[model samples]
Target: MSHQTGIKANEKLIKVFGKSKNGKLRVIKVSIENEELNCTATAEVKKDWERDYDKLIVPLIEESVPCYILYRLDSKTSLGYAWLLLSWVPDTATIRQKMVYASTKATLKNEFGSSHITEELHATNKEETTFDGYIRHKQDFAAPAPLTSREEELVELRKKEINTEINTDTRHQTLGGVTCPMSDATVAAIKDILNGTYDYLQFRIDLEEERIHVSKAAVVPLNELPRQVPTESARYHLYLFKHTYDGNYQESFVFIYSMPGYNCSVRERMLYSSCKAPFLDDLNALGVNVMKKLEIDSGAELTEDFLHDELHPKKFVNSRPAFAKPKGPPNRGPKRLTRPQEQSF
Candidate 1:
């Protein structure tokens, strides 16, 4: 769907946000809403600017499968798009888990720096971060007063402009509620730190340095004494996954998280009973031959596929019916593969 008329880039129909101060890309849930059949979609900052239709974006419109598209919109001149193959497209009642892992990229020298919140981990971008790193914060909060009367007037004018444009913002208006993975653990952690349960522990994180700055005023790192932090249930959900065969069960671990922001990636699932891995390695070993064994089909991810079969996969038999069970872009060039075949490499 090419929304290329008056839609401004500052006000994007699709948004990219979330992910803690860490590199974790906060998982987002999207479903087809008012315009279900409008697969011909496009967005732009200005009407006259060229609209480069990405081939991958076209195949993200499907009925059964909930599509996850990666949109990095800087402006009309600087932009990028891709289709994200979700690991599992759960029902409306989806769960978001808080897991942590460290990945070291072996790029030629060091080319790929962190780009968005979805990008969990990458080599440090010291140069860019030091100069152009932007600190994104919640906007509903109050801001410090401007130094001059002129500045105050400008702020008020800007605020008025924002108010006029607020209704068009579909990004913050979450169409669904998410039950994050660590609800139980998150509750306990917040209760302990945020509540008066503890003596007042101020915690902060430096996104650039990738360091946890925690301490009481005028104190030191937790070097008061040697101790081990809690690594119990924390590890269980870190890379929580299951490995199951037909009736029988096996072990598996997710070798990769989000792919290089591309189209039609297969995130497999298992069927067996439940178990916990206190270590990531133990869980990773379980999913050894997953792609090698189960991947059944591969083909060109064309616009037809994006809007039909390839973008969305079928749900499991026993799964409940989803609330809005349906749901990207323009690629005018010759048809191309919407997704890359994992086995072909």
Candidate 2:
């Protein structure tokens, strides 16, 4: 989906997009077709924040990192997308768990917003290196250790290794010949996921003793699709990190209109409109670069200044036409009496 505007940086949704049950973030499997992303920043994290960042914060950043390359689709700059540097303490409060400072809006609009975060994830681009390492200033800076020793420990301390074996079983045809009008890249990505039905996936990784856990469930709605999309929206929200087994990390698409009670509210029902196609266009516009970034980060260099001028054209993004409010009666003065007519007669 296109990067939504007015998205607060520290929102819980962004923080936990790929979180699984038990609260221990796991690299379930990324089907590409397969995928993932990266970047880093600097911050002085407190003890509490450092603890959470090690377990929680890092995963959140990894999942959404692809979004940065999306800015490459925008016509505004040479780089094409917004720059982001997430500092645990600076963006979100360790206590409240919500962002408490400087303008995320302005920050996201301008790439390189975080001085310490400016270190590109792929700068070193090591395989197995998923999250762009952040600097914990409260702790003494070690020129040698890019990632925390604890993180290194986690990487090394393999309690048990389980395979998240992935297989491509299903192939998809684009909504019965009604193709989505998206960029080739975006279209391919969608086709990649849809091509296979995630029949099932399961496994487990013992993370840091793997003790505590939390039950997670959600309804992640797909962006409103244009009327032209022929695919049927699924009725249920597929489990976030799994289908049933321990490590099943398959995710499913959530159709906006096809959802149960999606239009249940009378007022909200009035707001329904047919702009799904335009939204798809916008997503595809952003998809090409996002895909490029994803590819380059796999083990190559993606220059921060890679420039592209053509933008995915969007319509009615900001325009809000009046919907339900009644139109006022036309201004008409009461019959001016027969005086003028009678005088003329």
Candidate 3:
């Protein structure tokens, strides 16, 4: 589902912002009240912009509350105003409050012209809201200094190595084909599944770190496959289905890709898609002959009957026999010349 911009900028905020330059307003603290972004408080410029950092902006912040501080800088922008959007979302704030502030940030900036926002600051702590912290934040994102000849050579070599690695598929000993290396525990779990100790294995991807790890592994029955899938996120499932087909017992390895469609983000869908083919290739390289591959949008679709139909499809046959000509009556004599009396007219 798409994220909804629930918080709207209030009319009072617009009016206050129009007069901010003349009113000497150094900072405007915007907050969510009744689901609208209202001007909760403001700080006036005492002497200059730098002096108000400690004297004005410091005292307005509450520990548990998340707020947006529009700080005016002395630097001028092309729009005749240079403002910094300081997103002061504290760690102590509630999850809902944090989500609201994060989602509404772009909308807030767009409502009040984005061109005036020269810089943005995201601070979770009181220390980061200080002037020194702002300087450090700028330095962290600042452009790097020029490199020496030797340093340039080293950088070029590293780039070449990275490009080579990207162009060529390098199979690690532990995690074979996946770009996101699987955890040691996940490798061991996969071994257990291959060895018949476990009949089911599930995996989850760490999107931030770009790693794949085992989420669950157990000896689950065929009917329990649906329950094993999570409903909120995407997952990779390996199931060993043991059932009787044609009066013979057989074991088939089934690979299931379960994605909770609307629940997953766009990044999640892309990550899972890129990893899927390589993961299957790795499984095949490890001696797993996957008999059936299934993709599902929900756990409810991963049922025993569904798997059975995928594994063994019904065959059509012609039950009716071929048509044949019947034998003619045997002729006992030539013809009994019984010329019927010419119709006695």
- The numbered model that scores best in lDDT is 3
For 1-345, candidate 2 gives per-residue lDDT tens digits of 122224343333233322321223222211101111122222232334335434433443442222232101111233322222232221111211111111232344242233212222221122223232544321334446554545544643331233255356321112222111322332333333344432111111112222111111112222221221212211111111212223554332221222223322221121122222333334345431121111111101212122111111234476787688886678865656565545553
lDDT of each residue in 1-345, candidate 1, tens digit only = 011112121212223232211222212323333422111233332221112212223343343343323333323222232122222122221111111000011110011123332222111222211112111111212366434645644643442242233454221211122111222333343344323333222222232232222211111122321111111101111111233345655333221111112222111100000111111222234332222111112212112223223223555687776688343245666667778668864
Angstrom error at residue 336, model 3: 33
Q: Look at candidate 1 and tell me the lDDT of residue 38.
A: 16
How many collisions between residues are there in candidate 2?
A: 12
Q: What is the lDDT of residue 302 in candidate 3?
A: 75
What is the C-alpha lDDT profile of model 3 across 1-41, one tens digit per residue? Answer: 22445678889998887877563888899998898989999
Q: Please rank every candidate by TM-score, starting with the best.
A: 3, 2, 1
In order, the Cα lDDT scores of the candidates are 0.24, 0.26, 0.79
Question: Estimated TM-score per prediction?
Answer: 0.16, 0.17, 0.48
Model 1 segments beyond 4 Å from truth? Answer: 1-70, 76-97, 101-111, 115-183, 186-345
Look at candidate 3 and tell me the lDDT of residue 72.
88
Give me the runs in candidate 2 sitting further than 4 Å from their true place: 7-86, 89-117, 120-158, 161-345
